[model samples]
Target: MLDRLAHSRGLPQVIRTDYGKEFCGRAMVVWAHVRGVQLRLIQPGKPSQNVYVESFNSRLRDEYLNEHWFPTLLNARTEIERWRREYNEDRPKKAIGGMTRAAYA
Candidate 1:
């Protein structure tokens, strides 16, 4: 997911994340090092530090996950990708003066 974002939108200077195994693995550490990106890990048990992502995730679960039933992994991926595109391209965001996320970007 990070790789896809970097490819599509360019690399971010800094990545802030919690200490999830996926983010803390050796492969991710090496990848970040190779890309010259800074990875800032929030202190354990500090959900406030990653509030933005947490909030987005809550919204995703409420609006998408709880509402859909996927029969297979591939179908789930397809549906989630479609939801992602719609969220990024059409959903209006309050932070950006009610513009769609794509327009804000």
Candidate 2:
């Protein structure tokens, strides 16, 4: 998934994540090292350290995930991607002066 995103949008300088096994494992470490991307791990049990991601996750759960049931993994991916696009590109955010995230960017 990260590979696909990197191919489409280019690599980020750093990735901030929790100390999950998926992110902390050797393969992920190697991948980031090869790409010159820094992996910044938040403190254990400290979701507040990653406020932006936590907020996004909360909104995703409340506004999208909780409202839909997927019959398949692909369906879930597709629907989530659709919602993600709308959330980032179409939905206006008052915090950003009532502009969509893409437009604000």
TM-score of each predicted structure versus truth:
0.78, 0.87
Error of 1 at 46 (Å): 2.0
Worst 10 residues of 1 by lDDT: 96-105
**RMSD after CA superposition, every candidate:** 2.2, 1.5
- Tens digits of per-residue lDDT, candidate 2, 1-101, equal 89999999999999999998999999999999999999999999899999989988999999999999999999999999998889779999989999988
Clashing pairs in 2: none
- How far in Å is the alpha carbon of 45 misplaced in model 1? 2.1
What's the residue-level lDDT of 83 in candidate 2? 89
Error of 1 at 65 (Å): 1.3
Residue ranges of candidate 1 with Cα displaced over 4 Å = 97-99, 102-105
* Best candidate according to TM-score: 2
